[model samples]
Target: MTANVLTIAGTDPSGGAGIQADIKAMSALGAYACSVVTAVVAQNTCGVRSFQALSPDFVADQIDAVLDDVRIDAVKIGMISNAGIAEAVADRLRHHGAGNIVLDPVMVAKSGHALLDPEAVSAVREALVPLARVITPNLPEAAVLLGREDDWTVQAMQAALPDLLALGSDYVLLKGGHLEGEHSTDLLTGPKGTRALKAPRIATTNDHGTGCTLSSAIAALLPHHDMPEAVARAKAYLHAALAESDALDVGQGHGPVHHFHALWGSGV
Candidate 1:
């Protein structure tokens, strides 16, 4: 049976992140991808110029349209730009009793453009975080959620995972890519314990949509009903996509990872 995955996020015209990347990642992982556009961003590989958020009612309508027909097994949420939209999405998910929600706390773009409003952070934490099966936050997003200024090392990242889990998420995956290191380390913590995922950092500026891709991949694998195993496999897939990014050229600025690297045999 085909796993059906849904992504609620903004539309990135560059196809590097947001709903575009989530859909690509889900499809590449052998899942049917469905989407709800929360915002429309005028962005490219370089940066985000401007964005217009969709109405909360419209966002809910889109989600409802999909869930009413499709047997959505998993959901990936990203780039909810405001508090109202976040609340609406949360309420709809609750009403539908959605399962296996993977949240990518996308605060800013790789080019340092703020993708989420500072005022909306609290709304996301209070309304949406609790509903998530796994909350995936990169270093900057984690720092923002925790309200810390200092850089997060691997030890600090591991230590903070529990506090994130305490926010009501069943699991937390703290991505260590933003931390300066030779190898990228992602820590997954849950009711059991911490699972450290290590992969050699590819020295390239082509990681445009990694967080979105990773979270969606996890969601795609979650319908199998194995959280830890899904996370492990998703991490491996993301690492390979990054490794195979050397040959492809999408933009003059930071490009996207090869989402189909596995099929091309360019990744391990």
Candidate 2:
């Protein structure tokens, strides 16, 4: 049976991140995609200019409308612009008993723009993190969540696992993409133990929406695969997309990964 994956996030008019990237990744992975907009963001491959967050009640209404009708197999939550929206998303998902929740703590964008409010950090850590089956946070985000400095080495990342897991997620995917290495490694820790998942660091300027794509892809896959398997497959998918990202001419500063790289014919 096909899985229904819902993405609760903001917009990326450039179609490289947020709701646009989530839908593309889910569809590319053969899952039905659904979405609820939490913010309308003006951003492209380069960076975010400005954004307007939706009212918390309206965000909750959107969640209710979707959960009431569709059987959401999994949910990938991205940018909740403020504390109210963060609480609203958590409340609605818990109310619906949503499964396979993948939370990507998107604190700052790749271009150095802040996507989440400072006040929302606590709400996400308290309300949303506990509900996630897997929470994917980059080094900076992990540091913020733990109220400590960013991990600069693998050993430091390993040392932070217990605290990350204590944040309430069943599993924590601590991303090490910011580190200087030939292979991008991420530590996945849970009931079994910590395991490093590595992929060749494709040196390309097209890294937009990587977090959104990976988390959403996992959400799309979780209905059929176990946590470990789903994460491995999602990382592989993102790697391939990154490897082929240069094939397209999207923007000058940064470009989006080729989400349909495997499916689309040549010369797109």
Model 1: how far residue 243 lies from native, Å = 1.2
lDDT for model 1 comes to 0.90
Cα lDDT tens digits, model 2, 146-265, are: 999764798899999999999899999999999998989999999999889998888899999999999999999999999999999999999999988888899877899999999984
Query: How do the predictions measure up, each by TM-score?
Result: 0.96, 0.98
Name the regions of candidate 1 deviating beyond 4 angstroms.
265-268
Candidate 2 lDDT for residue 210:
95
- Candidate 1, residue 153: the lDDT equals 79
| lDDT (Cα, tens digit) per residue for candidate 1, span 1-268 | 9999999999889888888999889999999999999999999899999999999999999999998888899999999999999999999999898999999988888878898889999999999999999999988888888888658778888778778888899999988887777888889899899888888888888888999999999999999858889999998888888888876778888898889887776524
lDDT of all predictions: 0.90, 0.94
For model 2, state the Cα shift of residue 257 in Å.
0.2
